[model samples]
Target: MIRLQSLTYAYRKGAPVIDGLTVDLPSDRRLAILGAQQSGKTTLVQLLAGLITPSSGSIERLARLSFPAGYQRGFRMASTLGQNITFAAKIYGADADEVIGFVADVTGLGAMVDRPLRDLSVQDRMNTSFALTYALPFDTYLFDNTFTVGEPDFRAKCLAMFEARSRTSGMIVATKFARTASQFCDCALVLIKGQATYYDNVAQGVAAYEQSLPVAQPKPAAEAPTGA
Candidate 1:
């Protein structure tokens, strides 16, 4: 279980990104975080991942957590794919070869595993990142729009993997894709201007977002340009 009690944060004094936000994440539930740009979605994920400290309040975590940050793909270019994954495995004290094999099988990174990371395509790099994260045993997983970069089939596969993992561990996914979120998430958090409103269902979340938008008024046709 993950709990945040009166959490608050600010990059500049008196200008908070997350302000006294409190929530609990029941284990093994897939939660989708929806918010417009600058709504503090990424900031919330970072805090949960322990990448940043909260200015006030407390966060309680029950188990290990892993966050797939935007820069995780850079690890793919650090060395051979196998080498990078093995390094992570060593940090976690897992058998490197065994972990590599399992990741290769699960992520379908067969021959690509042996190749230098620079040679891999964007999809392959994403696969490597996911493989490394999934190989680790963590109780909570935080994904920040990583699936948006892959091809359709690969994206589908990634979604399946996330769903499978969610059956055993908690997952918090922050994305702009409503359709994808609706397909996998058990609950949705709709954030507007840094304030989060809970939505028990994805459809309700989407409807709320649509209702918040101001309808566009059509512009009158421009008069014919004066004779040049």
Candidate 2:
């Protein structure tokens, strides 16, 4: 389980992104986080993954957590894919050979697996990283946006991969994709105005998100000058 108590964070003083947020996420469940741009969704994901520290609160983690799949973390641009995979497996006490082989097969990078990450394109890097994370074992997987990783067929492949893993592992997905949240998540959190609203139903969360959106004020109509 992961718990946040009075969590608050901001890039600069006087302007907070997350304000006194509190939530508890349990294992073996798919939880979706929904928010508009700059609403602290990414920041919350990072905090939950222990990537960044909260400014004035606490985060308690009781389960093995994976880095948000799309975020670059433990990779070296100068290192080969194989080398990074090996290092990750070693740190995690996993079998390096098996993890490396699995990532190579899943990424389908072929002979390029031995090449430096700097030589790969952005898409290739994402594919490689995605495969590498999947190769490692963890209780919960955090994903910023699962659909952003690959092409259509590749995204489908990733979906299949997650479908298999979901049976055993928990997931926390932060996304703007309503379809993805509804399809994969049983619960949801809508982040708005530096606050979070929890909902048992994903659709309800989506509705709340829509409702929380700032409404545009109507322009005042000009009238005849002083009733001339």
Candidate 3:
């Protein structure tokens, strides 16, 4: 379970990104966070994932949470895919051999796993990283709009992997696409003006989000150039 109490955050010299938000996130469920670009969806997820601390309030986390599984920033650019996986397993207290076997089978990288990260193609690198994430033990996973990233076959495998993980772990996925959110989430939270609107029905949440889009006001007529 994860609990937030009066969570608030703001950037320096900027309005609050998340304001006085409070919520309890229980385990073993998928939540979709909906927002347009720069709506603080990423910021909220980072707070939930323990990547960043809130400016005010506190978070009580009881689950072993995985970082954004779709992220590749943590990889060692100079090391082999296999070496990276081994290092991750060691850090997470997982068996290196088990992680290697899982990554090999899932990514089908074969001998390429032993090659340097710099040597692999983009697709191979992404697939390997995704596989490596599952090699550790985590009760919850964080994702930031990473549901799509590769070839059709690879994507199909990723869908299957997510489905399998859904059976046992919790997930918090942030996405701008309402349809995708409805497809994978049991509940949704729409972020607007640094506040969250909760909806049990994913479709309703999407609808609410659609309704909240800012209507562009017409620009005022350009002032005639004043004579100097």
lDDT, each prediction: 0.75, 0.83, 0.84
Error of 1 at 135 (Å): 2.8
Pairs of residues at least 3 apart in sequence or in different chains that clash in candidate 3: none
Give one digit per residue, the lDDT tens place, for model 2 in 93-177: 7999999888778778768768997888998888877877777898988888663367877777777778777789998898876
Top candidate when judged by lDDT against the true structure: 3
User: Better model by lDDT, 1 or 3?
Assistant: 3
Best by TM-score: 2
Q: Cα miss at 5, model 2 (Å)?
A: 0.8
The TM-score, computed over Cα atoms with residue i paired to residue i, of candidate 3 is 0.87
Task: Tell me each candidate's TM-score.
Answer: 0.79, 0.88, 0.87
Root-mean-square deviation of each candidate, in angstroms? 3.3, 4.3, 4.8
lDDT, candidate 3, 1-228, per-residue tens = 888899999999899999998988765688889999999989988898778889999988898888777668778879988888888899888999898999899888878777888898887888887777766778987888875458888788778888888898987889988888988998888999899887877888889998999788999999999898
Error of 1 at 38 (Å): 1.3
**Where does candidate 1 clash, by residue pair?**
none
Candidate 1 vs 2: which has more lDDT: 2
Task: Report clash pairs, candidate 2.
Answer: none
| Candidate 1 lDDT by residue in tens digits, 1-228 | 778888888897558888887877654677788776777888888888888899998889886778663337337475888898888888777789988997788667878777888888776776667766767777878887654346676567666776677778877888766775788687877777656777777788867766765699999999998996
